[model samples]
Target: MCQTRTVGEFAVSAGDYSAVVVSQGAGLREVRHAGRLLTESPPVRPDEKPPLSAGLVLAPWPNRTADGRFVFDGVEHHLDITEKDRNNANHGFVRTVEWSLYDATERSVTLGVPIGRHPGWPFDLTLVVDYTVDAATGLTVTSTVTNSGDVRAPFALGFHTFVRAGDAPVDDCTLTLSAAKTLPLDPERQLPQGDPVPVDDTDGDFRSGRALAGVWLDTPFTDFADTDGRHVTTLTDPDGRATELWTDTGFRWAQVFTADPDHDQGFPGRGRAVAVEPMTAPPNALASGDDLIVLEPGQTWSGEWGLRHRDSAA
Candidate 1:
C-alpha cells in the first residue's frame, strides 16, 4: 500500500475573519467572517484531494483547451487530454501540484509555484497567489503570473470558489450578474461555438436580478458592465443575506454553476451552493485566440478578486 503525505496548510486570521489555504494547488480550504461560514469547506483526508474544484486557483489556462492542443507562433502544441471523456485538457497544470509558501502574515499568506517547461505546456512561468483577509473587507485573492521563458506564453486565469450564504439553499437565492451577453455552449462538448448572444429577452437575463429557483446554470457570461473598473456578481438569500464576488477589469468573464444534486457528479453539498468562477477568458480560448493573455518574456500580469458577506439577515 502507498500513502500520500499532507503537503502544507496555513490559516490566516484578523479580528473575527479567517481563511484556510492549502498547498495543494494553493486552494482556499475555508473562509469565514465573524465566526460564520461563508463557503463550503469539505473535510479532506490527508491523502485525499479536494473534490469539485472547491476553491481552486486556476492558472495558465482557466477552462478547457479543446483536445489539449493549441498553436502558437506557427507551431502546434498538444497538451495531455486530462478530460478523457471530453477529449480536452481541463483547467491548468498547477491545481494538482503543490506550491511553496512564499510569504505569510497573521492575516495573509502567499504561495508560489514555478511551472517549468513541461509536456503540453512548454512555457516557463511563475505563478503566485496571495490570500488576505481584513476585519472589515473579508477575503481578497490575487493571482499573478510572470513569464520566465524566452518566448511569450499563451495564458489565461480564473478562480473557482463555491460560495454560500449562511444555510440557504442555492435554488432559493437570487443572482445578479453585470453581464450584457453570454455564450451559448455546445451541448456535447460544453464549449462556446458561436458569437455571444445578448442576454436580453432570455432566461439568461440576470441584469434585473432574478431568483435562481429552478434555473439551471453552468454558463459563462461576459460583456461585463462594470462601474469604476470593478465587476460584481452577487447571490442573496430570501432573508437578504448576500455574498458578493467582485473582480478587477482583467477578469472579464464569469462562469456560474448551480451545483445540481441530481446530476451524475454532484458537489458535496449539492443544491445548496453556487460556484461563481471569475475567469479571464471563455472556454477554449487557446484555440480561438480570444482574450487569451499573452505574457512576453520578463513580463508579469496580475488580477484581484474576493468574497464579501452582507449580513442583511441579521
Candidate 2:
C-alpha cells in the first residue's frame, strides 16, 4: 500500500514556548512550554495519518454522521463514508486534504483551503486556520469558515488535541470540565443514544474534577459553566501543574475521552490518555439539526480555542 506524504511543516515560538504545525490538514503536531510537553506527541509517521486524530483540526462537521446521511433545505445529501466499520462519515474530508500555507511568521502561521461541491458535500466553502503563540498565554488557534455557495450551507467544527500536565501519566492526573449534561453514546457505534442526561452522578461527570484512573469516556458534554463566557477544560498532574484547553462562546459543546486501552484505538503514550475535544455542535448534528451552524452566501463563521500551561508557583 502507498503511504501518505505530509508536507509544509512549520514551527513557531515565543518566550520559552513553541509548537510544530503541518500543512496537511493544518494539524498541530506538538506543543511545549519551557521545553516540556503540554500536549501529546502523537506518533505520526513521515507519510501516515495522525492516529486517534491527535492534534488535528476537525471541521465542516466533526465526529460521526451516522450512516453518512443528512438532509438540508429539504434536499437529501449523503457523505462519503470514511469510518467504514461504523458506516459513518468521519471528521469531514478536510483532515487529510492539503491546505495552502498562505502566511507565516516567527510566532504564528496561517493556512487555508477551498472546498468545492462534492458527492456528499454540496456547498462551496473556505476554511482558514491561524496558529499563534503568545509569550504569556501559550498557543491560540482561530478558525474562520465561510460559505461560498449560492445556497445556505450547514456545518460544525471540532478540534482533536490531547493534553498533558508536565510529564505525568494521565492516570496520575485529573481531568476537569464545567459541563452540566452528557450526551449518552452507544457502546457500539459511539453515537448518541438519547437526549443528554445530567452528569451529577454519572460516569461522565467531571465538574469538580475527578481522577482519570480507570475512567472511560467517549462522550460529548454541553450546557457549560464558563468563566466570563469562556469555557475551559483542564488536565492537572498531581503536583498542581496544569495544561488547559479553553474555547470562546462559539464552541458550546465539547467531547471528552479517556483512552482506555481497549478503546484507545491508537492514542499515543502509556497509562491513561485523554482527549478534550471542543466542538461547535454535538455529534450527528447534521442528522438531528442539533446546534448546527448554517451560513448564507458570503457569510463567515469564526471561533477561537487554545492550549496553555501553568506551572505550580509553590
Residue 166 lDDT, candidate 1, scale 0-100: 61
Which candidate number has the best lDDT? 2
Q: What is the lDDT of residue 243 in candidate 2?
A: 92
Q: What Cα-based lDDT does every candidate model obtain?
A: 0.83, 0.85
| Candidate 1 positional error at 266, Å | 2.0
- Per-residue CA lDDT of candidate 2, range 218-292, in tens? 889998887987998889899988898899988989988766667536455554678889999998999999999
List runs of model 1 lying over 4 Å from the truth.
1-7
Summarize candidate 1's per-residue lDDT along 206-282 as a digit string, tens digits. 98789977777889999988777889888888888788888999999998887776665467755456788999999
Which regions in candidate 2 have their CA more than 4 angstroms from the true location? Answer: 1-7, 264-266, 269-271
TM-score of 2: 0.95
TM-score of each: 0.94, 0.95
Worst 10 residues of 2 by lDDT: 1-10
